[model samples]
Target chain A: MINAVGREIPDEILRMTGKEPFQGNSYKEGVPFRRYAPIIRPVMDNTHNKMVKDIHEALVKCKAHNGMTVSFHHHFREGDLVVCMVMEEIHKMGLKNITLAATSLGKAHDALVPMIEDGTITSIQASGVRGKIGEAISHGKLKNLAIMRSHGGRVRSLVTGETKVDIAFIGAPTADEYGNLRGVGGKSNCGVLSYSHVDGDCAEYVVAITDTLVPFPNFPAHISMTKVDCVCVVDAIGIPEKIATGAAKPTTDQRKLMMAEYCTQVVVNTPYFKDGFSYQTGVGGASIASTISLTKIMEERGIKMGFGVGGMTKPMCDLLDRGLCRVLLDTQAFDLDAVTNILNPKHHRITAGSYANPFNKGAFVNKLDYVILASLEVDVHFNCNVVVGSDGIITGAQGGHPDTAQGAKCTIVICPLLQGRIPAICSEVTTVTTPGESVDIVVTDYGVAVNPNRPDLLKALEEADCVPLKTIEQLRDEAYAITGVPNPVEFGDRIVGIIEARDGTIMDVVREIKD
Target chain B: MEILKPAVAGTLESSDCMVTVEPGQGKVNLDLDSSVMRQFGPQIKKVIAETLARLDVTDVNIRVVDKGALDCTIKARVEAAVYRSNDIRKDIPWGGAIK
Candidate 1:
């Protein structure tokens, strides 16, 4: 079956996931919102001590059993230990057919691979899947089709109760005995637990796992005690060092610098580059460098940005501190600098639902004027692949790529034309994680390609004397000429993972990689 | 082409690699240390060899401490190191070497 973006979804996959193919943007305009009403229970006492000895006791209190959905947050990134620890106890109790709905999964969760293979963990729903867990999923270890959702999509689905979470295990850096949790003021300080807020609201049972237990009231709590039902004290929730290990820095490489400059050129040339513009850029060498260049350009023009949003980085925070940007709406802090900045009142911490949930009346992304994103590969049609790698393996995540791209007035994708022998600009992307319609421009070291759908952007670039513009096909040809045509990835018939658009429609599917 | 002295290029960072080249015995002795050696060792080596071949240089000791750099980056660093060793900064054959 051909999706709205014209990607072919196998018939077997359609039957397995039973989801509608993506029918382009606004296709969900008339779609009905799933109504949900959870059973409300009032706290009878002010004991301020909901502490449990271990995860087992917490699970017992939550009425843990087989065939239940459990959720975790990936704010800790690769250093997270809560997911594995919770799954280990569940496995030890002989609980099978468990659904692990996490915001994302990284190498830290590799310990769950054996659980997946042994059928201890039966389902997975996440924005990111990598390392051993990704390999297991790619080989079709899970009984059900692996569901992938962007940060916004995950929030929307959870809030609407389309996917009921039985238990949401939140890893808080600091929490009081009463269950008031703060991301900071603890041994392991992660910036914000924004992603878990919806889980806390939707889950039947909410557990707060913490390493450092503060006093009676953890002031300035990210998750209030009212939302948390139980608290589990662990020796450690995550490795602080590894949690923010790959905080991206501006690249010194000339090729990346060139692309970053070009990205800035697009922004500076755009009609929306006036005062009070909003911006967002992801964490990567090129993307980080682009942020730096963008700020410099803004400073030179003496035009202040209204606000910066999305995953906060050091460069973005610097702009906020320098008064180049009025405010920073941070959902997840990508580094220590960002984490520290979130403490300041000027940098407001926001929830995941308010950040990008399309169903919401207002999202920060909707106010964005410019958003720069990274891509593993981009096709001539402007569709991007940030999920699967060249070897047909799941190595990346959707995160907020699609959400910000759709929300921003000008969405620029900056990447090198080639990665190794693989062409970053290709005939067609390996998987369409972000639809082409949302993409406005593709900036490479070779040249910049504006999406044909975005004629205004093309006209703006053309009007700029310094901007070098090229056709998307020309960029793809240039990449092929240098790297040569790549061999098509061989995929097995079994569908392993299903990519969900921000609207909860099927965007693409990743099949099993052939050994 | 013969290297005049030891030269180095690139930096040891994630998704980047540092390459050091020195004059060696008649045979090219390559020393590689990479985080992604298990998956991309062979490919990295092949890139190094191709880059050297493009520069028309051989019989050198090349050391690479790779941090998961792509082939283009590896090639660019290799070409830069070779050019630095030869002290040939002016009139670099950019198109030929990069291709």
Candidate 2:
């Protein structure tokens, strides 16, 4: 079946996953379903001890078995040790057919490639995968198809009982003996545990792994003891330096600055640029430059942002610090500056469910006025691809790109016309991670294009006449003129992965790349 | 043009390609590995083949590790590798065989 974005979701895949094709962004509007509840082992006796000696003991206690789904979070990013540590134990235990469910996976978890090959892990589910694991999956090494969900979609799956995680291992920066975990006051401080909040609440068994074992109460916990079933102390959960790197300085690249200027013009000229507007942006060089450019305009016009959200970066945190923004709802901290800024009262931590889950009553993304995102590619249809690269490899994550784009009033995607000799604007993206209907504007180094679906925004930008505007088709043509139209990537018949929309519908399928 | 010894041109930088050439067995042989190979592999090979044909280098072994280089850059690198293989450094063709 052809999805709303014009991508074909094979009938075999639809029948296998029992999922509907993405009809449109609002197909799930006003839909209702009962919340899926996990089997709870209530602790009423006072004699039970929650502290475990090591990961091995925790696995045994959690009944780690073959084909069970284990969950993890990516709060530690590249510095993460928990996923490898736990999986190594699981592999040593001779477990087979285990499903690894993570919020996200990166280069740090490349060690799992051997496990994926050896049948220790047969299935994988996550927001996305990168590094060798992605290559391994793309090469059809895994026994089962990988399910790729957006940040919001992950929560929706867990909530709707589509995915049942048997064990959730949370790598907490600090934890008490009774399993009260906190994100700060530890050696490896990664500002917020926002992504794991849903894991803690939805998993059948939740284990808290920590390097810093704080005093009994670890009060002001990010993951309360109520949801935690056990606690384990490790030597190191993550490397602090790698958990959150240095701040992202504004870009000095002229093309990026020009795109940033054009992005600022679009934001300011749009109807959602007034005071009390909410905003989100990625940590790309162009994205940071856009924030800087938008900051100057906001400062000049005395327009204070209502709230800034997403993976918190230094620039966005600086806006909160300077009182240019009223609040900073951080889901993850991208830098050490953002980690430290969480001490501010107004800098709040939010759960992944409240951050972008479409099934929730209201998510912060729903209130967003503007979101500046970076894309690997944008097609003539304005659909953005953040996961797959031109080489037909899954090299990036969807993060909150789809959610924010669909939620925000004005979703602006900033990308250069060409990445090296490969055109970033094409007739069709290698994969559609964000449908064109959600994206309102495409700001390239060459020019900006507004989605024809959003004529109001198009008219508003034209009326202001402050920025160069073109149709998305024109942008794709100009890109092709510089880099000749590329041949489509060859693929095998085996479907390796499925890209799910935030509403739990199949948006696109990733086939095995021909070697 | 004739193959003399092994030679290389260009760097493995973004928007650049490294071309290596050596003596072959009476036929043109090309091996290509590119970052953008899935999309531009055939196009890059066509440019390299055209460049080699223009220079009349029939018996040579060529290898290209492309970092998303353009067609023009691919041609220039291929020509540079061919010229360097024959140790030709003086009065080289600029817009003639090189283009």
Question: How many Å off is the CA of A343 in candidate 1?
Answer: 1.7
**lDDT (tens digit, per residue) of candidate 2 on A1-515:** 89888988999999999999999999999999999989889999998899999999999999889899999999999999999999999999999999999999999999999999999999999889999999998899989989999999999999998899999999999999999999999999998999999888899999999999999799899999999998999999998878875466777899999998999899999998899999999888888888888888899999999999999888898899899999999999999999999999999999999999999898989999999999999998888999888888888889999999999999999999999988999999999999988999999988899889899999999999988888888988898887789999999999999999999898899999898
Model 1 chain A: lowest-lDDT 10 consecutive positions: A31-40
Candidate 1 chain B lowest-lDDT run of ten: B34-43
Residue-by-residue lDDT tens digits, candidate 1, A371-473: 9999999999899999898767898889999899888989999978877556899998988999999999999989999999888878878878666789999
Candidate 2: count of backbone clashes, pairs at least 3 residues apart or interchain? 0
Off by over 4 Å in 2: B3-6, B23-26, B85-92
Q: Count the backbone clashes (under 3 Å) in each candidate.
A: 1, 0
Question: What is the TM-score of each candidate's chain B when compared with the real chain B?
Answer: 0.94, 0.96
**Clashing residue pairs for model 2:** none
Q: CA lDDT of A287 in candidate 2? A: 87
